[model samples]
Target: MGNVILRYINLMVVTLLILSFFSFSLAYLFPGHPIENLTGIRLENISQIENTEFNYSSGESLLVQYWHYMGSLFDGNWGVSFNSGLPLYDEITNVLPASIELSAYALFISIFVGIPLGFLAAMKHHKLTDYSLLSISVLGYSIPVFWLALLVILIFSLQLGWFPLSGRISLYYEIPDITGFIMLDIFLSDIDNKEAAINNVIRHSILPTFSIALVTTTLIIRITRRSVIETMNTEFIHAAYARGLSGRQVLVQHGIRNALMPIFPLLAMQFTTLLTNAMIVETIFSWPGIGNWLIQAIYHQDYPAIRAGMLAVSALVVIFTMSIDLTIRLMDPKRRRLKRAAI
Candidate 1:
């Protein structure tokens, strides 16, 4: 296991280096540099354009500049935002919790709702209930996130006036930032109406969370249903039934556990997917998250911020996925046996 982990870490390192280089190159090659965005001036004459003030390392070549950029990254400096003149690292950290909170909530909703629905569908396989859920899942997965988000906002915020239109929380309640998550912050705050504050946060979060989780939940349902059905058809499940075990007992004890083993790694991958999709959801909901921040950085052609954002997100995905893979191996006895045999 140790050797396997080491090998995976080595692979992650190589992959990150490749990802960083390409991402850095793409940011650098963007049509308008940060200088243009900051000064509202374009250098039409390439030959005459020297890095006099913008700090492109005027005396050094492109390779040297990139080398210095990589060095700075290692030194925990992501440079400054072209528009705000603040450190890119600070900006990323400041906005990261919003994205994390949003993604985590969406995943929680997906798992809790999806797994049981999937189990029921599998239990009632080839029946009307199964077909109905399958259809719903398919439709949910097919609907575009941005469109769904907008539609929900229209119904809930505009037409119905049930929820707020945009923003994380109402400006009326100034919840102190305890954990960077508004809900948690509200919970932690010394407010007169603690329950009301938390409820407000939940109400504000519902549309965006639901919209983002719709597709993810459907996908989970589909995967889980298929896995459970496959497990049910296996000989071990039949053997458990032969032992005079109740159907529910067999399913709860043996079937669901076996079925869910394959789903963990997939869940890990979904974390990154949710994070990427948050870019659109956050924009639509006007939620303050790293994804929205990155969009603004791109619009302003903040190359340093762009590069840093991409690398940070990529690193997070890679590390998280690898950790899940390791967890999956540890959780499944069959995987442990295989690893032992391979070793």
Candidate 2:
């Protein structure tokens, strides 16, 4: 166990370093200096822009600029946004929490609901339950995210009047910003009237969360169902059945455990998918998250912000993939032995 963990840690560190280097290189690959593109005021006087005292330069050697850029990255100085003229870190930090919150909610919904439905579908096989679940899964998977989000808004917000159409809360309410997550903020705030905050947060979150969760849940269900079916047909499962174990006992004890071994890796891959979905959902709901911020940054051609956003997302993808690989190794001891031998 210790060796496995150590190996994963090493892999994670190496992957992060490689990704960071790639991000830096990609940022520099874009035509023209990011600063020049951002400022719009080119420095005709090379000497003035190159002054060591002011630390403002356009004529510095490429090597020097590269080193300075790398150094700034280490110091968390991602430069100013050309479009907003605001510090990149400030913009990222402000929007990231909202994205995280949306992702967390969607993830929770996916796991809790998707896994169970999948398990049931697998147990039922070609029965009515299975066919019904498969049909719903097909619909959930096929629906386009933007269209689904709009349909949800129409039904729940416009037609039914059950939820808010957009934004995190009612404009009239004085919401105390604690964690930037509307739900958490409501819980943390010492507002005299708790009802208003609770109601407002729930009303705002339902549509977006449901939209994002529907797609992810469908995916998880499919993965879970496939894994469970495969596991149920294995030799070990047949042996358990032959040993006079009840169907329920055999499934719960032997089947689900083995099924989860494969399902875990698929779950890890879902992290990246969830993040991507969160971005789309955030935009639809006008939720304040990193995804929506990234869309805006791209539109305005804010290179610094774009670089930061892409780096963050790519880093997340790498981490999640590595994590899934490590999890598979941990769950399947044979894989770990093979990995160790290969190493």
Candidate 3:
């Protein structure tokens, strides 16, 4: 176990280095300096930019520049944004919570809603419920995220007025930045309007959450349906049924647990996918998250911001990937040992 942990840690370190290298390369790989591109004036003098540090200069070689960049990562001197003049690391930190909060909610919805629908579809194989769920999953997966965002905004926000159109929380309640997560902050703070704050936060979150959740839920449905259907045909599932377990009991006790073994990787991949889709969803809804921040950085051609955002996002992807693998392995010790033996 210790050896396995060390191996994964080493792998994660190498992955982070590689990702950071590509992310940091944006400074040279991009056509022009962000300031130059934004101002339509060539930066003959790097000193003109106020209160900022450049990672490298034209005088330095690529390897030397990367060395400085890596040093800055450990030294906590990631430089400031050309567009905002804020520390790039701090800026990434601020936006990450919103992205995490949104992704968390979306994932919750995907699993809670999708898994059951999938199981029902499998259980009802040739029935109307099965066909209906399949169609819904198809439509959900097929639609573009931006279009889904707009459509939901139109219906729920504009037409029905059930949820807010954009943002993480209502302006009516100013939750403090205790934990960076708005809803969680609201709960922690003695704001005096905890119920209202909670309610408003949830209401504001519904539309954007739904927009992203629908796509992931559809994927979960298909995957779950396939996994469960196959498990249903297996000898273990048949034995459970023959042991006089009720239909629901057999599916719930024997089927769902076994079916989930194949779904761990999908969960990890879907989490990353949710982050990618968030770039689109955040823009359409004007949500103040990393995706929206990254879009703004792009428009201004803020290389520092771009580099920081990409590295931050990439690190998150790698972390979640590793974490999920650890979690699934812990859930099934035999499978973990088998993999270790094979390796």
Candidate 4:
């Protein structure tokens, strides 16, 4: 187990170095000087921008600049935003929580809703329930996230008034930032209307969460149904059924568990997909998250912000993928057997 973990850690280190090289190369690989490109200013005198620490000059070679960049990473300096003059790392800290909160809710909805629906669809096979779930999944998959968000906003927020149209919380409640997560912040803050704070957060979160969740849930349903169906037809499942296992027991202990093994890798990929989709969802809903922040940075051509955001997002995906791979390897007996045989 320790050896496996060590190997994965080594792999992650190599992957991060490669990612850093490519991401840091943005400074030189891009057409103009980083500062000129970022700020849209043409300075004839190098001395004008030379004194400033943020500006990239023609004097420094890419290797030296990359060495400095890598050193800064170790020193916890993730560069500064050209547009805002704020530390890129600090900006990431501010918006990351919202993304995490939104993603968590979306994943929750996908798992709790999708898995059971898929299970039922697989169990019913050729029945009405199977056909209905397939149709719904197709519809959900086909709907663009932004459109779905707007549609829900029109119905739930504009017409029904059940949820807020946008934002993370209502201005009516003054919630302080404790953990950066609004729900946790509500609990920690000394707000007069705690109930109002919680309610407001929930109301504001529903539309965007549901919008992203619907798309992700559709994917989960299809994957789960396919996996379950495959497991159902296996000879091991039939053997288990013949061993006096009831339908529920066979499904729960054997079928779903076996089906779920394949789903782990899919879930990891879905997590990154959710992050990308989250940027769009965040933009539509005007949610204060990394996605929205990155979009603005791009529009303004903030090189530091762009580099930092890409690096952070890439690191997240890589770390998550590694964790999921390790977990699956540990849990799956077949992998363990293969590992032992190879050793």
Query: Which is superior by lDDT, 1 or 2?
Result: 1
Poorly placed runs, candidate 4 (over 4 Å) = 35-42, 49-58, 338-343
- The global C-alpha lDDT for each of the candidates, from Candidate 1 onward, is 0.83, 0.80, 0.82, 0.84
Per-candidate alpha-carbon RMSD to the true structure: 3.2, 2.9, 3.1, 2.6
lDDT, model 3, position 123: 92
Task: Give the top-scoring candidate (TM-score).
Answer: 4
Clashing pairs in 3: none
Candidate 4 is scored at a TM of 0.92
Give candidate 4's whole-model lDDT. Answer: 0.84
Stretches of candidate 1 off by over 4 Å are: 32-64, 337-343
Q: Which model is ahead, 3 or 4, in terms of lDDT?
A: 4
Cα displacement (Å) at residue 69, model 2: 2.7
lDDT, candidate 1, at 326: 78
The sequence of per-residue lDDT tens digits that candidate 4 reaches over residues 1-343 is 7787778888899999999998877866667876565445676775767754344433577777778778888777887788888888888988988997898889888989998898999999989999999999999999998898889989988899888778888667777777789899878888788887788788788889999999889999999999999999999999998999998999888887899888877887788878888889998899999999999998987887888888988988899888888888888877655553352
Candidate 1 lDDT over residue span 275-329, tens digit each: 8888789988889998898888878767777778888888888888887887787
Off by over 4 Å in 3: 33-58, 242-246, 338-343
Write candidate 3's Cα lDDT for 1-343 as tens digits: 7776776788788998899888777666778664443233455665755423342433467787678778878877776888878788788888989998899999999999998898889999989999999999999899999998999899888999888888877777777888788887877898898998888888888888889999999999999999988989999888988899998899778888888888776787898888888878989888889999999998987777777888888899998888787667667766567655542
